[model samples]
Target: MTYDFQDRVFLITGAASGIGRATALKLSSLGASLALCDINSTSLVTTTSLCTGSHFTHSFDIASSSECTHFIKDTISLYGKIDGIFNCAGINPTSIPLEDTTDEYWDMMVNTNLKGTYNITRAAIPFLKSGSSFVNVSSICGLHPFPTFAIYCATKYAITGFSKSMALELGPKGIRVNVLAPGFIDTPTNSGVIAGEEGVKSLEAKVSLGRLGSAEECADVVAFLFSDGARYMNGSVVEVNGGTAES
Candidate 1:
């Protein structure tokens, strides 16, 4: 599991917790320096604390276009180059039905999940050298419908399509782009919502593996994708779900 990315730089958003936090630590273990971004300053600090000091952190709103510009400028200026970029900052649209959904909620989901990713990747391309990787965090919801999560799923679907198109456009530059779609991962924030006794049983029943996923497990796949091991893998959607969704 050793990645030969020593001294390489990776920029990751949503690094404060969950999958983002796990990936940050995992990449650090593989010897990559990092520029971490998140809105949660307190939690973002904690995430960087788990890594080597060869990391810089920014507490900027991913939903803000101006802030995204400034964040990218600072990272490139500070690190000189970026070898990988992981777009993970996103909001889960509220579970209210479409009729009850507000303009604010729809805008929030689109801004954070869709526009935010566009901002960073678009800005970082000039800073990335050839053979760099771009990994966007998509979800199973993007592929399969979940009741009451329309906008959330839509954003993810857009990311999936967008990643494929970008992969082709950037391939000539030797920059690779891929998406990771994780299903039913058990993180602290989602523990209560998806991990109670009844909830757990229902989720387990839905998956052939009969269990939930862990953030650390998903991180492993992403680490490989970001490394030379996944060199031929571009314009791909790697599903980490436990046989819960079928192609």
Candidate 2:
């Protein structure tokens, strides 16, 4: 389905690569103005180069509230208003058992995955006008148990809960919120998982579709949620996992 975002402005975190980059390209093609954020300035430039519309790029760590506030302020200053936000900035945890998870590892996952989502969404809420929307990227781990991904699962589970609550709180004001749960997407984030033939086969076997998903495929769902097509979808968790973890 084709979506028209001619005059809309969108704020996207983690736009440097993976699903975020794909979403940026998709929305840009649909004629939307963009405010892209990423901590990696170099990779972000590459993403901006591939996009085809008016856009501004900001480099900042989303875990910092001050940076998030500044990024939102600057985005509004440049675009005048934000019509949607895609909270796709996140970190993948190593497949280590919870008992082996160190304090540093735990902190990094919580800060980047959970706290970062909170920081960005809290900062942008004031500027999100009526008819605006927010899409938070969770994971298949959020909805089902993954043996060695306890910490990662915790963060994504928190995101699912947080997005739902935000939808209720913001829905009455005309701002919609939803979550996207993606599984084994073929992106830099899963480079290790698809590194060797054995790894690829093992991962694919877990998916009902017998293959991994692509970043663009996940982006399609994100674009739909951000468009008027999903106007009635709020506090919903849409899975883009190739039938993995079906329940």
Candidate 3:
């Protein structure tokens, strides 16, 4: 379907790289105005340069409630309104067994991944109008298991649950909430996964498509979720894991 985002304004966290950057470019090409944010200011600027028409960029900690409020206010001040939001800012630190995980490490992951998503969503909710959609970035691990990635999996699972609940609460208010669960996407964020040729093959083998997916590929789905085409879709979890999700 042909997607057009003319005059629409979207707020995207984690726009510095990977699927977030790809989605910004995709939406911009479709004629949307963007408010992009990330903790990495340097890379966020690069993403802005790659996009087309009207856009703004911010570097902030999504984990901070005040920072999220500030960014949302700035977006409203510039665009006057928000049409949608993409909650993609997150982190995947070194994976270790649950027993080996420390309290500090747990707080870091929970704050950035789960609480960060919460911060932005809460801040932006009041600004969203009817038909606004929320496309939250989860992971295959959110739906499945990764032995040593307890904290990562926990945060992702929380996102899925949170998004679904938001959909139920916001649907009557004309807002749609959905989840994007990607698996082994070939982005700089996941460079370590496909580090060696052998490693690539091994990882790819787990996917029915027999390859790692691309950030751009995942971006396509994000665009659809935000488009008029998906007006009826709400509280749905869409997986872009190349068939890795259980049947």
Candidate 4:
């Protein structure tokens, strides 16, 4: 099916950076209005400014339940409906032994990665018009094992589970829920590795495609996932890591 997103309203979290930023730009270029939320107002404003029309921007912590409530309210107050939602805001701050993972770190990662996705989706459920789409951003770590990333991986895995259940729950309303699992996408956060010569070598070898991925590449998939093109795709997990996931 043709993916035409013209005049659609797309709500995206973590819109300030990386795949989220790229997807927001891509969607806006396709004639979609946007509602971007991020903890970083500085970059968040830049994202909203790039959108097609009177796009809205809200600076709120994804980890906070109350803030999510406010952000969703502001979204509908600014735009009557939410046609698509991308839960792109997340973090990876904890990297320790299972025992060393502090209560604070564990909570932070869990709240941001898991609860953040939940809070946003919960808040957006009402305003999501029928036939709308929700794409949750999960990582390949959720699919594969990684050293010192136990909690992070657990959270991403939870996304897949939660998304599937949500798809079934929202199916009657014609709302679709799916997961986007990306691998080694080169972004500012990972620039240290992907941009460096040695790190690049290591990353390229790990990918079955013998290369790293780009934010735009990931964004392209997201654009389709949010469009009518994905009308038949619900409760699916799409991995855009250039065969790395398959390997």
Candidate 5:
């Protein structure tokens, strides 16, 4: 099904790569204007070059509330208003047990994965008028526990909770909020997990689909959540994990 976003403006964090880049391209194909940001300036430009619609790119760390505020402000200045937001900026955690997890590692995950989502959403609230939608990128780890991914799971679980609460708070204003929990997707971050024969089988064994998902698959769901087609979908946690986990 085609979701029309013609002329609408969207603000996407982490647009340099992975799901963020895929979502930006999907929206662009649907005729949306975009305001994209990421810490990697080179990759951010590369993403822009692949787009077919009007877009503005910025480089900043979403963990900094001030930088997020500034990026939102600049986006509004450029597009006049924001119709949707994709909070996709995040960091992957190391496979360290909780006992071995240092304060620095914990802080980094919380700041980027949890706090970064909060920072961007909080800053964009004022610009997001009635009918605006938000799609936060969580993970299957948010819904189910995984060994050695304690900190990452914690942040994702927090995101699901946060998005649900925002959905409730923003519902009266006609704004919608939802979270997407993706399973093993083939992205740069997870390349190691699907590298060798043993690695691929090890990861695939956990998925009912017997293979990893694609960033574009997740992007398609984001487009739906942001589109009027999902007008009634608020406070919903949608999983795009190829049946890796069921609720």
Candidate 6:
């Protein structure tokens, strides 16, 4: 479907790579003005260079509520208004037993994955008007547990619930909130998790499509969520997992 966003403005986190970069490029192609952020300044600049249309990039920690507040201020200062937000900044650590996980690890994961999303939402709420969309990136693990990934799963699950509640709270204002539960996508974020070719095959076996999803494929969904095509969708959890099934 064609989406024309000629004058719309969007805020995207984790814009350096993976689904975030892909979504930035997608929205840019659709003529949306963008405010992109990531902790990785270098790669974020690279992603900006690759996109079309007017865009601004910032490097900051989304886990910091203060930084997140500053980010919204900067974006509103530049664009005057926000029409959409994509909360994609997060961490994905490899599987480790619950006993092996420590409080520090839990803190890091929750702060980055869960708190980061909350920070962005809270900061942007006032500026978002009717018809605005918010798409938060969760994971298949959020719905289905992954052994040895308890901490990560906890963060994602929290995002799902938080986003749903926000949808309920914001729906009356015409601001839509939704989530993307992506499976094994072929992105840098998952490069370390998939091991080698054998591991890839093993993972693919769990997906009915017999292949990992792509960042661009997920980007398409984000664009749709922000477009009129999905205007009626709110508080929805759309899974882009290539039909992944439980073992």
Residue 245's lDDT within candidate 4 is: 43
**27-104 in candidate 6: lDDT tens per residue?**
999999999999999999999999996588889999899999999999999999999999999998777899998999
The clash number for model 5 is 0
* Greater-TM-score candidate between 2 and 4: 2
lDDT by residue for model 4 over 128-204, one digit each (tens)? 77889899988888788777878988999899899999999999999999999989877777733644888778777
**Per-residue C-alpha lDDT of model 5 across residues 62-135, encoded as one tens digit per residue:** 89999999999998998899999999999876778899989999888999899989999899998788989999
Better of 3 and 6 by TM-score: 6
Better of 2 and 4 by lDDT: 2
lDDT tens digits, residue span 112-181, model 1:
8999999998888777789899999898887788888889889999999999999999999999999999
lDDT of 3 by residue, 1-247 (tens): 5588898999999999989999999999999999999999999999999999758899988889999999999999999999989999888657588899899999988998899999999998998888888999898889987788888989999999999999999999999999999988888767446367776787788888889999999999999999888889999999888888552
TM-score of every candidate relative to the true structure: 0.95, 0.97, 0.96, 0.93, 0.96, 0.97
Please report, in order, the local distance difference test score of every candidate based on alpha carbons.
Answer: 0.87, 0.91, 0.89, 0.85, 0.89, 0.92
Ranking by TM-score: 6, 2, 5, 3, 1, 4
Q: Backbone clashes in each candidate structure, one number apiece?
A: 0, 0, 0, 0, 0, 0
Higher-ranked by TM-score: 3 or 4: 3
lDDT digits (tens) for residues 1-247 of candidate 2: 8899999999999999999999999999999999999999999999999999658999989989999999999999988999999999998767897798899998888988999999999999988889999999999888987788899999999999999999999999999999999988878778446467787787788888999899999988999998788999999999998877643
Which candidate number maximizes lDDT?
Answer: 6
RMSD of 4: 2.0
lDDT, residue 1, candidate 6: 80
